[model samples]
Target: MGHFVIPVTGKPVDYVAQIFPKNNLIDHGVIVENAEVYRQANSDKIKVYG
Candidate 1:
């Protein structure tokens, strides 16, 4: 099992959380102030800017 972190911007964090739950398989998302935090946490992270 792998981990993933998705930066939240523009859209509501709840909406993104709905799409990707905590215990789901294949996909997951999280909101962080900095993308580096995600990487530092040792999870794959994606940044969204808008």
Candidate 2:
């Protein structure tokens, strides 16, 4: 499986966790101040999760 790191903003980390299913989303948690990493499949067009 491919790996990727997606940066998210303006949204609760837990909410992101709930939105994206666990099967695809490996990690959806806070990385740093106002930043979160949504590790999933690599894609040229990433869904902007606010």
User: In candidate 1, what are the lDDT values of residues 1-50, reduced to their tens digit?
Assistant: 55565544455433444444454533445554433222223245544544
lDDT score, candidate 2, position 33: 23
Clashing pairs in 2: none
Weakest 10 consecutive residues of candidate 2 by summed lDDT: 39-48
lDDT of 2 by residue, 1-50 (tens): 46644546556444555444555554533332255333343322223335
TM-score of model 2 relative to the true fold?
0.32
Count of backbone clashes, every candidate in sequence: 0, 0
lDDT of 1 at 40: 22
- Give each model a TM-score: 0.26, 0.32
